[model samples]
Target chain A: MNAPLPAAVDWPLAVHQALSRLGFGVIGYVPDAGHKRLIELCHGDARLRTVVLSTEEEGIGLATGAWLGGAKTALLMQSSGVGNIVNALGVVRECRIPLLLVVTMRGEYGEFNPWQVPMGQATPEVLRAMGVLVQRADTADEVAVQVDAAARIAFGGYAAAAVLISQRVIGIKSFQEQAAQ
Target chain B: MSALRRREVVRALLVNRGDLLVVAGLGSTAWDCAATGDHPLTFPMWGGMGCAAVTGLGLALAQPARRVLVVTGDGEMLMGLGSLATIGVQRPANLSVVVIDNERYGETGMQKTHTAHGVDLAAMARAAGFASAVLVREASAIESLRQAVHHGAGPHFAQVKVVAEKEAITLPPREGTLLKNRFREALLGASASLQ
Candidate 1:
């Protein structure tokens, strides 16, 4: 078998660069193990401000307002949060506000929660139906490069861009990993 | 204002000589406020509720010199009413929120909204910390928007009553995500100025 990936590569830096390329001065997120390092980087950076949201919908709203005020912004959440953001899609579809959303996928590849499966399977279809652009990252290296491209598509085209992180990239966070073994 | 009248008003505003920032929705009023050509940024939809004003607030906070406006629908606004308080606390002078109060979720269907009949939206804005708020129910909305943007200090709110109508306007999708790139560059430029 191949060797496990080293932790020294620094996923947070990659995510930070990706956010910068996406024109995000501020980002809204709901904390999760998949995004812990990324979230810390955003909070620590002076150029980037992190808005911790109570709900996924609030992050969407905050990103929208940031776009209007002349600052580029993005939302970081999990696949579960995508369920909470569906109704708000009408605002972006009608307004054409080009938002960049980076979501950590939960249901694919040894998912623990049954509730997250539907949204995970439907993510691409749902995004396409709403006219959003979606991309998936299976590795941290890909997350950095692909996210930059996604951000360009979002801002350059005035379209919403979504980056979905696969389970492999996130690894396991809790007892779920032990149970999987 | 009728739906058609609202469209005329928005169209007029866009055609006028000045930079414009608008928050649209999948509703009649949103189609009415549709913007064309190269805009700074457009944070399109993904079913997240109550994000229009919050996003608008972010942009306004970043770009103090630019005249930022959020053209949100009544239903969408109600999703994040708490943002009004957030806006109040931040006090972005360049920002103005123009709520197209048709009193219904026009895009999903003609479902009633909380503001379907004179729901004192302006009063709510005032309570949320806006220095000025107004309600208008006529075709003369362009002037009101302009006035609100010009006089907007702290946070400003305006409710424009419109008749319920839903229609789609076809436009080519924007390409390559220049909107986000430009926004970052703009923010960097703003940051440079602060130094």
Candidate 2:
């Protein structure tokens, strides 16, 4: 049956549900077509405020600011962008600020770009090496639950937590439909 | 330096339970994820230069009572050379910087760095007015870390020779806005508390 039509999954809705229950205030993200739907959900949700950034490292500065501002924040970036936030990891560790890192993975499954390979391979290793907790979801079915768990681990433990969303769960890049047209 | 030597130094320093340690660039390349506590905030935001010590300086300034330790790479240290003088002038007693020199940019495909020439980083720190500085090759990390942290004297700088590890591990894509929000939250929260 057309490979299950990719399940029309509500991954972002799940993310919203988890964040709401966890009381994570605002979310800062870089726009990625893979995350557009979730971005829209975060925009519509009253419990969270969304700030968009041009670069991943900007999210680091922003999140640090948010924490200083008395709001819990979450960073949503794709696999390649995490490379841009390595400095933030250094800053955060030094600042001793606790937050959540929600990473939507790219470059692993049927990746088209040669550039994505390096960051994709380094994501988990880098996170682990820095002592940031890492979690991965292989399918849309697991996104929200794992995100909730990661949130608890982050806030309750006061340490950085990461959630990795795989390409199979993210499915094909549908934004291509606009470019194709 | 062998992984064992690096670990020896890290373990020695980490024993000072409540202190904050920030590692920049590939200095964290082989770090043990489970080695942190409830308060450690590790920044791996960008794979670039000069950011580790700058961030460490900020933390030292913001939290004067908390000891802040930065593990930086030689390549990264070269990028932000000006911070040496800045740290000296600020004279934050809680700050200590340790540069791990592998003589190369171990992260981006093993390119050579200024450390290959054996530039005297400790002398540079001294010239910049740091109260204490030293250079220790591979076998001496354990003693150096112990001495640096124990002195509790002032802004301390040390260079540790390390052997580069050749391996590539992928990182997740950029979450630009999210990371900014998280950092902003931290800054704002701290400021709010002061008010």
Runs with alpha carbons beyond 4 Å of true place in candidate 2: A1-5, A173-181, B1-195
Measured over all alpha carbons after superposition, the RMSD of each candidate to the real structure, in angstroms, is 7.4, 13.3
> Which portions of model 1 miss their true places by more than 4 Å?
A1-8, A21-23, A49-72, A84-100, A128-134, A140-142, A152-161, A173-181, B1-55, B58-62, B79-91, B100-111, B116-148, B158-195
> Against the true structure, what is each candidate's TM-score?
0.62, 0.49
Model 1 chain B worst lDDT window (10 residues): B170-179
Error of 2 at B155 (Å): 34
Q: Write the per-residue lDDT of candidate 1 for residues A1-181, one digit (tens) a residue.
A: 1222445456668879767755578787877777887888888888886777657776666765665455677888888888777766655665566778888877677666677678888877777777788898877678877778788888777678898887767766446453553
The recovered share of true contacts, given per candidate in order, is: 0.57, 0.08
**What lDDT score is found at residue A96 in candidate 1?**
63
Considering summed lDDT, which 10 consecutive residues are worst modelled in model 2 chain A? A1-10
Range of the 10 consecutive residues with the lowest summed lDDT in candidate 1 chain A: A1-10
TM-score of chain A of each: 0.87, 0.88
Q: Using DockQ as the measure, which candidate wins? A: 1
lDDT of 1 at B36: 42
